[model samples]
Target: MLRTLTRQSPLFTSSVRGFKTSAAAFVKAGDSVPSLTLHENSPGNTVDLAEETKTGKYVIIGVPGAYSPACSASHVPGYISRGGELAAKGVDGVFVVAVNDSFVTKAWGAELTQGKDSKVPVRFIADHAGDFATKWDVLFDASKFFGNKRSKRYAAVVENGKVQNAWIEPDSTGLDVSTAEKVVGQL
Candidate 1:
């Protein structure tokens, strides 16, 4: 009787079993960056990534979160220190994206550009709802560590609204594949 009931249950139906769906494919070379508005300080002050990259060569660096050890120490600093060199290589902008609120993102940017007298060109923007990363298929299930969805570590070089190149880390949390140095080298 138990076996029969289990088989008859709606939850155990074949339709339910076959309901699994694959995630969207990650962004690739030649794909246009999604038109998503990310926040710089608050929702009022927004940065439209697709619009920003429409006419320029830009690098988008995605991180799990702001103030995280890997991000604060090595990941972001790598780009921060090499901003000039990257610009010299013809990269017009370098954007750092995180799945945090705008306030945290702004504060973090302030900390990174403390003594530069506003010369640092890196724009640290907030993907408040993790929407931008999700659209690019770079959102990772970071519930265990971040308590919510977070972006995978990756970088994409975009030119005139399309991706020129993409470097995504094998492991979402790993630091090797998508570091600024490596991406810049590839550029």
Candidate 2:
């Protein structure tokens, strides 16, 4: 049989799949945050992020877990320390959501913000069974590490119930694009 292609054949193309440095994330600007019943401080206190942000601007930061290493040491603290700066950027409030129970979230929030300048009043919330993350399509199977599903680290600027901007860590657990400094600087 005769081979149709040669080294200089125009029909020949690389076999490697196409790769893009910046892939389109599941969350994007203009996406509406789901109106789910999330717990705040306790199960009795229910909050709907969509409803809360429907009439104002807010920053929603989703972490993999409430007391995880990155979340406790750097991620949450960064936002707490720079709360004033975030407020100056027109962000009405900043909420940290984790796929943990309200009790854990409440304690973690208090510990993280104990002596910090809470200019923007970062509200730590319990995503409560990863409902928010699943609805928003930011849930990932972290079973190997977390032993359960978890939310991807993301920072979104919501205005009038719509996402004005978002930065989701492509790897789901990294502390890069979703870092407080980067998100705040852009805003």
> Top lDDT: which candidate number?
1
Show model 2 residue runs off by greater than 4 Å: 1-25
In model 1, what is the error at residue 33, expressed in angstroms? 1.3
Worst 10 residues of 1 by lDDT: 112-121
The TM-score that candidate 2 achieves is: 0.85
lDDT score, candidate 1, position 180: 82
Query: What TM-score do all the candidates reach, one by one?
Result: 0.88, 0.85
Root mean square deviation (Cα) for candidate 2: 6.7
- Indicate which candidate wins on TM-score: 1
List the lowest-lDDT window of 10 residues for candidate 2.
1-10
Clashing pairs in 2: none
- Give the per-residue lDDT digits (tens) of candidate 1, residues 1-29: 98999888987677544666886588889
The CA-based lDDT of model 1 is what? 0.88
